[model samples]
Target chain A: MTRDELLTALFPAGCSIQPGGFGTLRGMAELPGTGRVEIIGIEAGTPLGIEGALILSGHVLDLVAAASRAPLLVLVDTAAQEMARREELLGLNEALAHLAKSLALAAETGMFTLGLLYGRAAAGAFIATALSTQMLVALPDAYPSVMDLPSIARVTKLKLETLEALAQTTPIFAPGLEPLFATGAIAEIWPPEALAARLAATLAAPPPRADTRDALGQARGGRKRAHDIAAQVMAQAAAHG
Target chain B: MNAPGMNAQSDYYYEASARERAQGLLDPGSFTEFMGPQSRCLSPHLAQFNLTGAFDDGIIIGAGLLQGMPVYVAAQEGRFMGGAFGELHGAKLVGLLRAAAAHKITAVLLALDTGGVRLQEANAGEMAISEVLRAIVAARRAGVAVIALVGGRAGAFGGGGIIAASCSRIIVSGHGRISVSGPEVIETNKGVEEFDSKDRGLVWRVTGGRSRALLGGADAYVADRISAFRDAALAQIPNAPPFTLESLQAEQARLSQRLAAYGTCRDATEIWRQAGLEPPAPVADLSEADYAGLSRLPEADHDAR
Candidate 1:
């Protein structure tokens, strides 16, 4: 979906989103029942680089400095990070990390930090934006991938055809909303019809700050023992560390 | 000069296994691992793919003492899948950090050595990194100092680089390279003229530890020895800043200024030259002394983090 279509549907109550750094969107929106929320987002398919990330991070920092702890919604729709020498040379990792850190700081301020993945995302750019949020909900048609199957095939020495065939049924390495949901990377899939209401409802009562994707993944059976392992380690450290 | 400490120790961090690094970094016999090799924390996904899995899943997680100050330590074995983060591998680190916060442990030492997520288990691996990031920040918010120690064969690219960058303090050795995408990935995405992965020296200059340190991407540049890392870790433990709005603001400014100052530069050398730290010799040709002596350069005000 286009950014405009997604934003309109999600904030039909009205929003004032302005074009932001390099390839970003930032502004404010008011839901029907919920108070104003700061919207930080990326333009569709724009591979996020240093400039865009810094600007997004700056927005997050601004939200943290607000007098009242306001909710922040991230509209993530982008490809992976720019694969260029200049981006890497300028420390894209640090830039993306800073963006993630800023979102983390916002979460620390007792704000309801949530991401609405109405478009698509992958790799470093995804982690810096959609994946960094306190909770993530996605549109049913949203696309999410860590690495493309062709690239994954090249790296893993598996045939692209084989990878493609497996991706259809395998949630572990597949790229799509359903597979991602199965892995619990996406907390919920917002129905297409009631995005604005969904936004308001989610804002009214957000999930607990404690991350539970692993537990969700475990329960869904897409992942195994990740939650148990973390719990065990927590238990051990409580007794020993 | 090359050895920095001149200890002439064969305890090269790049050569050590995750368990060995964890053992060598902590006080003798202090580490009590959680779900260690004996526990066989293998990767179910790798097994599903008919690939053999490492018993420890490429990461070592547990707690030990750093300078008699109780801390949680986790290290990655670069030999296993180039230290790529599989589901269990990422979970182990997350577990360690979460445990640190729960126990109110003073700090968590992270030895990063990976090219980020494993493609075989991409969904789980990617989600693992996100969870790890959440865990790290959560631990820091709870007053646990998370210090990343990087000096391994893999050099912490991709999500590994992002994780390292998020740490309260990062100590990188000449052997360590940190970046979002590795050279080959770039070469694949953008042509070889942009970045030839075979050019090892070019890789070092672009994403190597010295370059990362000079650019303020890393806090400290240490020698490649495990002892050097341990010493750096010991030094940073007490001084590690708690994750607060003020600290992040400072970091934000530091990064912004960095972009503004060197954004136009096409090469890492340009950044170094712009920072006014032109070495008398090229970094590669310089003796160990010339290379490891970056701290002697003018300290940037933003280096406090």
Candidate 2:
């Protein structure tokens, strides 16, 4: 069934769902008497940063600051942040920082930040959502990676034919839900049939005290122990210096 | 000191020499290049796989001045591996940012033009970008501004897009395309009918300046000229500060409204109209700066939220 169909079935009594408008960052939710928000798909490159995407992302944060209320549900669908020449000119780092700050602020406000990766989530987008959430649920089909296949080819300059072959056996070069699973970025995968119920249950739950980005990192064997590894590096640097 | 055959400056402003452009973009004589061609920090993985690598590890990292404010800049050299972010490439960038933040520098400018997460050194590249993001977060928390400049045919794609999105502010030239997957990947996955990679107009609408501007993804859209970028960057750097929760929540509300208005729109013009701009022709024709000036969300609008 289509995602719309599933939502329709779950919200049979004429529920109100809103779409994110252009130049507008926040999505509102009027749940009966309560004013709940559903932040769907804070993806990258939704902006046209002729110079860079990050500058616009910072502006997006301004829009986020405009929104009121907490306990939002962020449905994540970004593959990564924008990395165009325009984005660089506009300051990619600063743009993404805005979104990160927004998410961090949301997480700080007792906002029940639930991440639902309905599609792809990689790199900065993954960090943006995961860093702010208590836990993240990935749809089975969603593919997450730091970068995608062809990009790997372009960056690595490997023959397309060779990279395609390597993608099958190597999780490092390949992008998908399975690789993300191997990375421990995902806490659970919700079957399409169970998506609506799971989301509803998540929305009903309380906000988590701590973010799971570092935890997920350790869980996936990517960094070993978040700051533990970073601590090691810092200690070594300090000793050497 | 012009080279024997080379003009003091190149003809195509957008495609000018990366080094020359980087030098010219900042305050005169302010740039102190790190690594540089002299460093010979080319990708080790490149020659092992028989691929060529550029000197300075395919990225130019150093310090410069933007209007006398101390700024650290990193520019990707697209000529090398399409400016892929390799281990050394990412490390140089991360190191520069870490130092800049540690020193309490005022700003960081990243001139991005690459397909992110270099596959030859994919693991290190990915880790590096993640670290950079964390670094930027730290910098922002401590009151530093980061600005990304997107100008070049290579534009930004893949992981590069996320890096752009993470910045505190962004400036884009008309030529850039910021997206997770360039048209090729979208076409491969969604079919040619959904997105023809060759369709310049379609590609622009998906990730181009006008589309992103309407989407509120870019803070300012500059002309293809480099000076335009300098002006926009200068304007944004001063406004950088850690935002309060109310401000962030407001921005979130605005994004939600924006997606609602044009999430299904077929044309960039349509999105522009919904964003309170005069329809297609007018918005499309405005110069990058003029459009940005007119398009900023009004104070009243912010208050209403």
Candidate 3:
């Protein structure tokens, strides 16, 4: 189905809708006349540069706080942030962190957060949205990794020729589902054909653990020590308190 | 000039390489490395996309001593992807910090020299960095002194800047610059015509060591010289052998005041000047003895009221 058709089915019958930045449909979706609001929207990366991600994140936060939603639906179609000298300098990482904080704060304050990574889920901007949520569903086409090749060569100082040879065998350093899966950094990787079904299933399931991402790491053997460490930290804090 | 019998102090000393800096920042030799060069944790994503590089994922994390003080140190190697943190790199950092906190290490020093999260590994890198932040916060709760040392050429830009900002104490070299967004980003987002990224003075004025120090972001500003950094680290040891929430809260409050003062100034030099500190031009030119003399000036009344 087309993007709009997918969004139309997700919205409540009477909730008003409007176009947000990047041509994504945004509006409140809730049961009729309840006045309770659930901000729902879809965003694309091709427009707004990568910096647009921050703007999109900010708008979503404002909508949620203004509407006081219990669960928020985020539909992502980012190919990743634009690679520009300016984006790096403006401290996109902090902007990215700010978005993460918003979602976390919302989660702590009793909001259900879900993300559908419809496209490229590359870089911090991409991860910030999905990782901060209770569940993340990604389309098969998504190409996720820390960065591209030339940038890596420029910084790591390795001869590009050498990087090519080594990448062939090492999934740990490669992008896509392999590395994330190995690290248990991602909880679930869904196919494009079955995304809708998966999303419905996840939404139907009880809100998973506070951070299923950490548990996913252990269950999948991607990240070796995240859960244990988090537990240790909490234990220490509790003992002190 | 290199005569064998020369007793010159310069002859006996040599500058530390990035690797050596990473090694020496910790204990004499207690560093047990994971995913180091031998482990070959180079980025698979970068290579898949046709980038080339070497070493253990562009970061160095291990345990060592800082003046008999047991500690864990993470030195970001900017030479590698601007010292960006990718999946493995971030994992290593988070893992080590986790290890340190779990074991209750005396301190954690981050010799940050990054442009932030590596782009090739962007997705994982970003998550890893956030995880590390949460980890540092957790570490601090266990009385672990977290020191962010920013002196290397990368100067802790990008996401690394935020991580540095959240540290218990930030130790910076005069040449270092720490900012949430780098000047280039400002120029890009705002416009190059409005701001110049090439202006060294402008960059320093905005985020340099003296600026950070005056702004109260850096707990102390030491000379760019490595020995000065070592000395400053030693000085902090006596006062804070173990990190505690109360101690960190006090430091955080102090940092808040430092940040607030920036609202009233345009440049670090001006902030320092207002703080009664000798400006950087003169301070940078001062001999070790002269600089020490200036540093010993009666403590200014800038402490939070």
Candidate 4:
């Protein structure tokens, strides 16, 4: 779906998002019955370099500076972090962390936050943005990948065909929305239909106070050991504390 | 990844095992591992790839004391899978951080030594990184200081770099490095011209601990000694503030200033020169004491542990 169509569907009342200097989406939307929510996003199908990431972060800080208690709707669509020496030399890792920490501060300050990932997201870009949100809803178009299968094949000395066969049996390392869904990284697989009502419903729900994807992953059968192992450690640490 | 100037005056933290680092950094007899080696929290996914996994999944997590104050700690073994975060390795850290938040531990010391995700369970490892970031924020919000000590051979790349940045403070030795795309990954994907991974000096100058410290990416720069890290952690943890909006704003400005100042530079040497920190020799060749002097770091006293 096009950006306008997605925004219009979510905000039947209409949104005022505008493209920033580098393709970052910013502005606010009037959500019926619940009030206005601020928006921050990376434009679809673009690599998120240092400049774009900083602009995205600037929007997050703007919300905080306004003392805005409105929910933050992060529209994510990126080809992931820009792969360049200058980006890393300038500390892309720290910049991404700054963005995530800004969002965390927004959440801790009592504002509800959610990310609508509607395009491909890879590696550090995905981790520090879409995954940093309080809730992540994957649109039908969402495609999240870590290290790709090709790279894995090369590193492991396994044939590409063999890797494909193994991918069918395990979603743990594959690159698809459903695989991410099974891991509970994407809280819900959101269809383009009825976007307005669905968002309103999600906004009305109580905010999450703890990260629960591990439990969700276990229930979905994509990941079984994470929750149990975390619990075991928590239990043991609790005993000593 | 240790710099050539690394001194023999100190026991090399770069060569220590995960457990050895953990035990040596904390109070004697005060470290009680939650999932010791016997727990054998092996990565279930590695076996699917026909790879052997370690009993502890290359991370050591547990409660320990620093001069009698209780804290939580995680030490990653750089030798095993280059300390990559497989499903189980990541889970162990997530669990430890969750416990740190729940118990209001004084601090969470992460001896990070990772090159990021293990390809065998890449998705799980990625998700685990997200969880770990959230838990670190939570722990800091609960007034628990999250500290990272970096000096291991693997030198914290990719997701590992992000995790290290999320902590309240970072202590780095000249041997340590932090970056999303390390030299090897950059060179492999891009080209030798983009980043010559074989140019070890350039690699350190770009991503090494000295560079991070100079750029304000790290809180402390120390000797490659376990005692130096212990002392720095001791100094920073109790004093680190709870994660706050003001602090975030301050950080935002610091980062923006960083961009405005060094954004166009294509090399770390240019960056250091702009900052007026270009040593007479290769930054890597500066002695620990001389570099520390350049960095305004006081001489570290021995036997702090």
Specify the highest-DockQ model's number: 1
lDDT of 1 by residue, B1-305 (tens): 12221233467888777888888888777778888888888898886556899989999888777767898888998888989988888888888888887777888999999989998998888989999998889888888999999999998899999999888899999889999989999999889998999988888888988878777778777877888898888888777887877877787787777778888987877777887878877786776777766543233425334
RMSD for each model, in Å, please?
Answer: 2.6, 8.8, 8.5, 4.2
Candidate 1 Cα outliers beyond 4 Å, as residue runs: B1-9, B294-305
Q: What DockQ would you assign to candidate 2?
A: 0.14
Reference-based lDDT, residue A22, model 3? 50
Worst 10 residues of 3 chain B by lDDT: B4-13
List the lowest-lDDT window of 10 residues for candidate 4 chain A: A42-51
**What's the residue-level lDDT of A110 in candidate 1?**
86
Please give the range of 10 consecutive residues that has the lowest summed lDDT in model 4 chain B: B296-305
What is the lDDT ranking, best to worst?
4, 1, 2, 3
How many pairs collide in each candidate, listed in order? 2, 109, 37, 0
Candidate 3 global lDDT: 0.57
Per-residue lDDT of candidate 4, residues A145-181 (tens digit): 8878898898789998988999999989988898888
Ranking by TM-score: 1, 4, 2, 3
The per-model lDDT (C-alpha) reads 0.84, 0.58, 0.57, 0.84
Q: Mind giving the per-residue lDDT tens digits that candidate 2 earns over A81-133?
A: 44342233222333454455655555554556666666556665565554345
Could you tell me the interface RMSD of model 2?
A: 7.1
**Where does model 2 exceed 4 Å of error?**
A1-127, A130-241, B1-13, B241-243, B279-305
